[model samples]
Target: MQQLFKNYINTFRGLSKEIWWLALITLINRAGTMVIPFLSLYLKEDLHFTVSHVGWVMSAFGLGSVAGSWLGGKLTDMFGFYKIMIWSLLATGFLFIALQFINTFESICIGIFIVMMVADAFRPAMFVALNAYSKPENKIRSLTLIRLAINLGFSAGPAIGGLIITGLGYAGLFWVDGLTCIIATLVMINVLHPKKAKVLDEIKNEYPISAYKDGTFLIFLLAMALFGIVFLQYFSTITIYYKDIHSLSELQIGLILGLNGLLIFIFEMPLIKWLENTTYTKLKLMLFGVVLTGLSLLVLNLTSWSGILIAGMILMTIGEMIAFPFSNAFAVERAQKGNQGEYMALYSISFSIAHIFGHNAGLQMTYKFGFDITWYLVALVAFVCAIILYFLNKKLKTITN
Candidate 1:
């Protein structure tokens, strides 16, 4: 056991200090991620928006995310990751504050769109920064470390957010979230300057054609997008399910959802390390992750028992551990040296597309078809995604080998 623990630590030993600070920045930013988790609930409950209306607003956020991701990637390649990230973080802070004051449906929709656009632009820039800071060999482990930080903060965020919402209501959530962004931005500006100052100049001249022209990668994107649609339900429709169907309070729902992040935090790093030694390829593990995600949703519908709910959540978290980081590493591997931002941006766009399907379609389906059928539909989607990913991986492996 001691040796195993030591080996796990060794996996992280080669990574640079910048990677560690990046993880810290991620943790600080995510720790205040209270607003999005409960956005549907707030819109439905406080603003008296219908479920469909909530879905529309959320989809608007998704649309903005798509635009933001594409623009962020281009901007990162042009202006560099540092300025892009700093502006994204600070702009997101201001938007969050602005969102609190918007109560009308049209106004809130516009607010959500702008907020998401500004906030989500940070993602591609962050990934680009990660690529610049870490060595190629340490890439996967570095991404895992950052995800570990994210999940750890996620574990805390919603729990604290739940308490805040219960005591002070939704406005408090926005204020706290906004303040955290500012703090993260301050840290980035004052303490953590870029180690790879030449990254901008290095990649500036090596422009490639559009990612859409790459057929294999496009297929991979489609498969991953389907997986993302299913994976994102935990954020979108599941909250409503717990509230309406299970009659759980916000605090209980937050705690239950927080369990996913807690499990990921505890197990993901060690699991990634273990997988490194095993014969299983990253794609195979990701396939298993997708299958587990389907099973997680299926498991939830099997019974109304609380234990079953927790069990399903555990399975979903395990799926996340297996799939999400590896999928990212795969994208990074696929990119040409100078075009990492564009590839990562395309990957980000896939998840943004998922928000459209996962939120609008999910909520609409639940409203019309009920949770059982909706969940089964999502499960079937995951199963199909796994199959597609399997073939795609084999193709890539053959090409590389």
Candidate 2:
């Protein structure tokens, strides 16, 4: 037990102070993530929007994300990540507040699009910042640490968000969300001064390639986008499923969703650390994670029992833990061989594209055919992507040899 505890604790050693501050900033920012998880519910229950309307609004959010990510990445390369992060946070904070006032379907769609455009720009900039703050050797663990903070915040956010909705209504969620973004920006400004933070020496490639021209990396991104589509459903349509199908309360739903974050908080670091020491390739682990994620969806169809919900959540969380950090590390590694900003931007864009399709597709399928069919379809997509990734891995090895 003592040795086991030591191994777990050792996972956190050797990270720079800037990485810690970045993690703290992420935690503060994500803790206020009350709005997105409950956005579908808010639109449906509060504004009386139809399911299809909710899908369109969410797609608008995704479209905005793609634009934001691309812009942020481009700007980060030009102006640096510090300015981009600050501006993105401040703009998004104000937009969240503004979004609360727009009630009409068309107006709300535009509002959400604008809000997400400003907000998601933070993602690529944050990745660039991660590259700057962390040592090359510590990159994956650093990513995992940041992810831990995010999950920790997510664990708290939904439960607290549910309570806020209960007491202060959906309006309160926006206020809190806006305020948190502002506060996180303040923390970033105060602590993470650009001059003080140690920027790592860049690893130069013999022949730097444009992210756009890299055929192998592009295939990897396509697989990632598909995996993202499967993963993101837990945040969007799945919430409605818990409520409409299982008749779970808002608080219950929030707690259940929060469980994903909580489990990642406890288990992910140790798991990543352990996986790092294994002979298995990162691609293989990613493929295994994809398989688990697909099975998580398939498990939903096997029974209507509420117990299955926990089982499915556990499967998905484990899959997420295994897949996301490694995928992030892979993107960062690829970015180092080219224009870091552009490479990371394209990586963020892939997931943004997933957001574009995942929520609307899941919601539409559930609305028309039923939840069972949606699950089957998404699960099948994930498995197919896993196969693609498997082949992509083999192709990468052939090139290396």
Candidate 1: where are CA atoms >4 Å away?
A: 1-8, 195-209
Steric clash pairs (candidate 2): none
Q: Write the per-residue lDDT of candidate 2 for residues 1-401, one digit (tens) a residue.
A: 89988888899999989899999999999999889999999999999999999999989989999999999989988999999999999989888988899999999989998998999889999998998888988999999999999999999999999999899999999999999999999999999888787787455567778999988789999999999999989989999999998898889988998999999998999999999999877788899999999899899999999889889999999999999999999899888878888899999999999999999999999999999999999999899889998998888889889
Model 1 residue 365 lDDT? 93
Which window of ten consecutive residues has the lowest lDDT sum in model 1?
196-205
For candidate 1, write residues 23-86 as lDDT tens digits: 9888999998888889999999888899999899889888889888988988987887889999
Best by TM-score: 2
Superposition error at 191 for model 2 (Å): 0.4
Candidate 2 TM-score, true structure as reference: 0.98
- How high is the lDDT of residue 393 in model 1? 81
